[model samples]
Target: MKQQDNRALGAWSRSSTAVLAAVAIALFGAAAWHLGTVALSVAPPNTLSRHYPRWIADHIHPELEQNWKLFAPDPPQGNGQIEARVRTVNGTGARHTAGWTDLSASDIAAVRSNLLPSRTDQDLLLYAWDYYALWHDQLPGHPREARLMAANLKRTALQRLMPQYQGQRITGLQFRFRFDRVPPPSWASPTTTDRPVNQVLPWWRVQNKDCQGL
Candidate 1:
């Protein structure tokens, strides 16, 4: 009986070892595959990625998508900001134009102090503007989602100024974009003078419904 019990115990130990080894192998394989996919996604176009573009896109898109805009051979040389002003109608029907407010500055300030800033602070305005820019052409051009994007941007600006304009109806909104180019290093180009460029958009009339609930 003692010998039989020893043999059974030995068999159980071996089985457990085999199961653990199998699990470890499976885990390692999965991890390797994941790393390889990420590497392929970010690396410059290669034969493997070029051959299986669809497969790689399917693995990384919409969530793990990579953006190399800020790094590498071609990086952004300037920063763009959006500012807005509102036209408010007082109770007596007097129309007033508010001074320009730097909406992007508020987002930048929110991110400066907090260790973990919310996406609203970091991406809300930036992404909205980007979407608008992507879908719309220059002024007077109508494209799909162009009007909608404009409305969205105006809505956000209105929401921010609602408290300040209480009792007055927000009637219209206008946006301006400024791009500030970074000056080259003094050692590289000491005479270079980088100036900010501004483009002001026409005033867009706002609907009463759009102003509802702030």
Candidate 2:
């Protein structure tokens, strides 16, 4: 009878140990799952600006307030105000003459369009072109130095603009910077030679519009 009792106690102890082991495993699994969920919920730091446009404007226009203070004293009255004229590809033009402190959504949209890839590679190509133009004007007839300056400007502009966003999806459209020499056929005089050509060598033209107006 004593031998049978010992056998029953041994069986109970073994079963209890097995049950505890299973419980421990389940608890551990639940804890691991909870930790993983918390990790996924947390967003990566500095992936995106808290206020994207304001942040961008701050970076782009650091002396904006100072400039406004200087210029606001003699604010342009009525239709004589400094106006931003946006010329679209379709020959339509829209004008905005709001104060610098009051930038409307339309103004922001127009600015964004200038930087956008679909409209033009303004961030990359235009930056390089403008730099080349400025450098060439400063030191005329120096192709090697002009090329180096343009390249450096391009690299700096890309570094400033091409920031990686965590949740934002980057498409092939965003990466596109391929420039075509073909001008739109709707121009008044469409000639093969009249189309704007990418100068193999940077040359300063007096007719070039000042990009600082942006």
TM-score of each: 0.56, 0.21
Choose the strongest candidate by TM-score. Answer: 1
TM-score of 2: 0.21
Tens digits of per-residue lDDT, candidate 2, 26-108, equal 99997875454343333344334333433433332212212233555653121111111111121233322212221123334
Clashing residue pairs for model 2: none
RMSD of each: 8.5, 22.6
Off by over 4 Å in 2: 1-110, 113-125, 133-144, 165-177, 181-187, 193-214
Per-residue alpha-carbon lDDT of model 1 for 1-214, expressed as tens digits?
9999999999999999999999999999989877888899989899998898667655664347577654755654778898988999999999999999888897789798899889676877866776677557543343434666776777777777778888998888889998888888768864545878778889988888887776
